[model samples]
Target: MTLVFSTCCFSPFPPLHPGRLTVLPQEALVQIGGSIQLNCSLDCPDGTPQWKGLDTNLGNIISTPTYSLLLITNATVAMEGTKFCVGNCQGKSHQGSTNLQVYSLPDTLQLETQPKELVAGQPAHLHCSISKVYPPGSLTLSWYRGDQRLESPDAEEVADDEELFSYDSELEVPGEKVTEGMEFRCEVELLLPPSDRSFHRATAVTVSTKGKSWRSELGILARWVCNFSCQSHFPMSLAILVCQG
Candidate 1:
């Protein structure tokens, strides 16, 4: 009688790791009509990576086992949105995302004096306008006189003639600060996330009347010399002496 035994060993499956997906340039900032690119990576050596958001068709999309890339060209405000990077490994999925923000600086910034003339003790107006702006809430208008900063006023919505937005605001001129020739500067700032852009524009308004012009007074003096030979030792009459000119 003979006994025979057979044994076989099987290896367990490796752990599943979708891996951590990383998106380069966590956030993107692009101006209108410009373009941007985002890089993506899945740490796992065997993971499949892909870009899942934005206008993927705008540019080339490179997908490899180690990394993926998304390119956006001729970008517009409409293209601004959340972009995602997705990866899969061992039937599990992992992902990460970034925000694409698109903005435009004011097309035309203008500062003007309403009346184009200012007078001490008289109220005048300073006007600031920002045209062709995007992301409505980003526009801000500020006023300044010389080296001093003035208060900010509520911005008024100007009628939009095109697809973009326009904003304007007026500040009452400081009668006390008004001078014969002085410039008032208006600064327009577009407060975008991660940055702030500024544009300085100023307009000078001359005072209609120079200061102290009304209260100015003048006085005249006349000097007269009369040649008179006093008679030797002659006493001149008091009234005649006083009248001599």
Candidate 2:
């Protein structure tokens, strides 16, 4: 009697995987006219994988059973946003996303001056104009004297083209604080994605004080100190006195 094989008694269920999805380079900061590449992977991949939130026509994309790659060419400010990819893992759909930020910086930073001569004790005006910057909202302008931060001024309101914008800031230096040969610096900070970057321009003014040069003043003070020290320690060596002077 050929025993018919007992009907197989086994339950089939889909694999138990979290279906974790990952996107490499989750955040990117790219200059305008640059390119970016992103990778998406899924755990226990199953079916076809695809990309979303970006125009496929603008990028080169490769898909596989477990991962997908996307390379965007000639990136522009309009393409700055979150991009997503979807993958199938264990019969379930998994998705991952990355953030893209595009920015531009001026080739040169120039602080425009109103007067040819910056005289001490005179109210002076300076203007910093930054052009062709993306996401202008992330830009800030600050003023500094030597290593001391003076102030951070609000950007002047301007028409936004949505692609590129210009920032203009005007700073007024009070005459009372102005000193001859004092340096004033204008710094621009880009609070873009990934990190913050800074650039600066500096200027100085001339003081018309009717007094001996600072060098001469220092020399006189040095001589007074040397005389006092020599008198306190009488018969001090001339070489030591000269060294102190």
Index of the highest-TM-score prediction: 2
Worst 10 residues of 2 by lDDT: 202-211
What's the lDDT for candidate 2? 0.71
Per-residue lDDT of candidate 1, residues 61-111 (tens digit): 888897988887787767778888898866779888888888776445676
lDDT of 2 by residue, 63-181 (tens): 88778888887878777788888877656777878788787777666677655456667878878777777676777777776677887568774645656877787778788866777
For all predicted structures, in order, the TM-scores are: 0.65, 0.66
Each model's lDDT comes to: 0.69, 0.71
List CA RMSD, all candidates: 10.3, 9.9
Error of 2 at 217 (Å): 18
Question: Which stretches in model 2 have alpha-carbon errors above 4 Å?
Answer: 1-19, 151-153, 160-162, 193-245
